[model samples]
Target: MQRLATALQIEHDASLRTLNTFGLPAVARTLVRIDSARAVRRVVDHPEYGRAPKLVLGGGSNMVFTRDVSPVVLKVEVRGRRLVEERPDAWIVEAGAGENWHDFVAWTLAQGWPGLENLALIPGTVGAAPVQNIGAYGIELKDRFESLSTVDLVTGRSVTLDARTCAFGYRDSVFKQEGFGGLAGKSVITHVRFRLPRPWQPVLGYLELERRMHETGNFAPDAQTVFGWVCDIRRGKLPDPSDVGNAGSFFKNPVVTVEQCRDIIGRDPAVVHYPMPDGSVKLAAGWLIDACGWKGKSVGRAGVYEKQALVLVNRGGASGAEVVTLARAIQESVYGRFGIRLEPEPVIV
Candidate 1:
């Protein structure tokens, strides 16, 4: 390994205001830019930081920094993308952990790959995608995930993990857990591989896509069309982080038992819900927040989005505390009415 001092770009007291999508005020006491797996190994072996607590940060799209960071920040910037292999059954594609998730999806489609169209325009980096098991519309990252390479934070050893080992759940993976065998805060992902099957079939029938098809009179939309529609729909519903400081979706839709769903529906007949295959019902958190009269509501410069109640936006110069306050208020209201606790989607740092 190269000398740790020579192989890394280390910064002190770095401003993280712009790094996070929420634009929350925070500073990293020591921030290190890691461009490769070797660089991460260097960080692990370096005497000055090897034993210290560290935080791995990607595009910061899925984070809300509440205060100045104390742990050594590993800003992963490893970059690469390629077709690893092609077979009769599937195409193996790979991307550096640092690549933008949305851009990578578009690149895959441009190269004639179509499996990732349903996930286009989601925020954050490819490395972060597996950590969250990100999903949108009718597809989740785990559906196409093959494997990922991660470097141990303590030993500098690299290991590749597949979907089964990842233990994916709703917007979750092993990387998001720290109990028992969880890899959370223990390793840094350097690259990811995806398995895109051949003889592509578009994943349609999603409510928004169905609406687009109905309006356009084009029922058989291609991958590009699906990608375009997703992008357009996202633009219309979610606030762009650049224009308004906000993480895309602030809360995950709460899942409930069939009996619980019936109880809530009895209270509010218009409650929007979907019956999951597992016999559970997924309630729309945005609708719940809106029903609680939180839409366009503000608490100390942090507010629920008027256009989409699922999002909490920084109304300009908002602190992370204020955002959390607003989120808690919304959560309490939803729980009081529906008896379900709404869980936040972003990682609060």
Candidate 2:
């Protein structure tokens, strides 16, 4: 495909190594950067590309590409952020789907918004957050979500969907679902609004945060303080992609029933687990992998991060298949020992 003198930026046989955080090698046959909502409509109307399958990409922080892509890659580059409204009870903020999530959180704090403090330093774009229902410490995006606007791929129609319409769950949303009425691959999220509640109380529920508070001898901390602490904690634990390639956490913390939790506890008293409000138990996947003696272990160029067992890092020039292989071996071992299946957090492409 040749470039046309149009608003859309198109590239054929685009190298995806630098695009993905893991630095996995892959190529897109046709890659188009969509800077605005209108770009999506234009894509649907393109002469040669119209009717072709599409794959939407954000920061590529949460995806692992194992092979070259055949679908047209729509790299979302939409940008903007603003204060939507300020009520007595809460403050509403809106951000483009393509905006860097961590930077957006920092901007909110600089503007005196406090609700997103716990989620500070998380990777990926604001658009990907809702799709993954990204969470950290004690708060999930749904806890602060207001609504989002998206453009339909088939009809090029725009619509705003509330939390219910998104059907958010643990690291999932309607955008990640593909059953009947599911929105995955059928729409492009252009903008997302977050509802930051007023009179913010610090979320010190997580063990690491509590340790930080105790070590600092400060029971009460501000939002910026919390933000700094979260960033520090993340930096110390997870390897920076600029230094070492990684896709953050590798697996979702599996949630099991209370009875099932007891069964695991009976076998291993030292298993790291958290009790949920609804009587379920969330087991730490990192702990499970570490207990199985997989931390700092490697299969080819892909290895688990020594500092944080949750992260799988690309040691030098690692391939996506190596990462997947390492992940599968960890899963099989964990299932053999704990009888719990670990689901990968990254989208395997």
Candidate 3:
């Protein structure tokens, strides 16, 4: 029998293990694939599923499911990309929310706009980028963002929001917020626009990129070179999701005040940290985890990635509950030693 909820097709008892990078076993009670702005509205107007709780899923790279999902899952698959505008100072490009983030970055460079090169090879969708405020190798999504369009769940109205309204911060945005003016679980992003600056300047101050420069004797590299370098660096550090089931960085680097930083440095001078412009310091979560001797360690079927302590991998057939157990253990150990609690990066379901 053909199952239809108005214009939307619903999948019952949908397997989510294949959708998420962690590859944990779970099922979505109801699932719908959204490919356009109208499709999102259809979901909002549906009779039964409309008012029920909904979960907007992107690339599923940053999600961990601990149990069968009860909320309706709207898997965004909207697609398209094009050059929007070219001004003297910048070239504006746009892409559908569902576009693969890494692919879009590569596509922008191919089209001769090169500002997104440093962010190459990051997993997840373009829609998820702004939500996570994704960053890498000295560049962040906000660094090249212009604006994005979203469909409100209640009103079914499409609105365009700028960076200010998005309230982008370290791995966070209004999309992840839930107080007054928060958009979390309230809207679905349909399209995203990027303000790629006209004159491409390679962002190469990052340690790994700098080391690459020193090794290659190339003080100045093009966008493609930087892209290659970032891909190589990430490949060496992070295990591919295909080979190992794991979400990318499991925790956000804890930011501390100058006094706290000094105290930590006093206790452990070898701690890896980055000083921010605001005078606070960001300590590497991976370094803290490794210091606690958690790398390559496991709790049941879940374990820390042998290559990067910041990542939790499914050794094989691991349950999401086991993964959470492993994460908590790491957090407890790190807090015991450094007196700092690590916040997870992925959305735990």
Candidate 4:
């Protein structure tokens, strides 16, 4: 770890509390920010630190490091943008993984690109988008994901993986699975490429977005209008982590057997369920938590967001343990009430 500072300013005693949205105070053993693939390779291939575990980090939005850092923290700072390819009506934009996601979306909209408008105002970096297929307002990152380029730490070589190779699923990609080094301090995402639609129709399939569009009396919506609507909806719903610490959607909507959903719905017909193609049903995790009476409840410094049950906020100086404890209590209560165990979406370290 001593040679880590040669590649970048390796900061010890770095307060990661500000880095993460959770605002949980923790220390990193060694933290280095890499601006290029060469710098990443240098740290990963160092013979002195042979086989030591590495953690890759981006904007530090969707993670909860419950304890002090365990391994080296390598913040991916690679940044750039280019028009990789263009057609008569569409274009492929490539950006460094570390680029701010909202900035990229706004840039695309300014250029009159239409596909990314629905995903406006999403938190995190472009590099982390492909991992979870980040989505909102009826559009997902997978809808435009062309390919992603990454550097393999073990071999210190670069590789470009196409969308199919990415293994994208509902809020999941190959990089997110266990043993895939998807967690922080493990694998670095260097660059991301997106294919944008030229004359795209505004997706207003989401109920709230649709209702807002109707209320605005917009019969025919364009990219900019849709982007504005999305930004408005997100701002009205999700609390900005900068002002109030929170990771949006603390839990993934649990997918369960169709029979399981039917059984639960029989008792409470108002329970919402989305039928899946795989003969399963997706239950709204937020609805389940609200039903369990955990919404707006606070314990210590952590509490469920008063407006959105899916978000858990750090009202004050909450420790990671307290947040996790509150989350566990919600999980247990929901399970006890509905027999469905909710799983957290963000990676908790």
Alpha-carbon lDDT, every model: 0.91, 0.93, 0.93, 0.82
Q: Which pairs, if any, clash in model 1? A: none
Give model 4 RMSD, 1 decimal.
Answer: 2.1
How do all models score by TM-score? 0.98, 0.98, 0.98, 0.94
Q: After superposition, how far is residue 174 of candidate 1 from its true place, in Å?
A: 0.5
Supply the global lDDT for candidate 2: 0.93
Count backbone overlaps in model 2: 0
Model 1 per-residue lDDT at 59:
92
Per-residue alpha-carbon lDDT of candidate 2 for residues 193-272, written as tens digits (9 for 90 to 100):
99999878788899999999999998899899999999999999999887899999999999999898899999999999
Error of 4 at 105 (Å): 0.6
**lDDT digits (tens) for residues 246-281 of candidate 1:** 988999998999999898888899999999999999
For model 2 the local lDDT of residue 102 reads: 95
- Better model by lDDT, 1 or 4? 1
- lDDT minimum window of 10 residues, candidate 1: 1-10
- Over 194-251, each residue of candidate 4 has an lDDT whose tens digit, in order, gives 9887667677778887798679898688888888888888899789989999878899
Spell out the clash pairs found in candidate 2: none
What is candidate 2's TM-score against the reference? 0.98
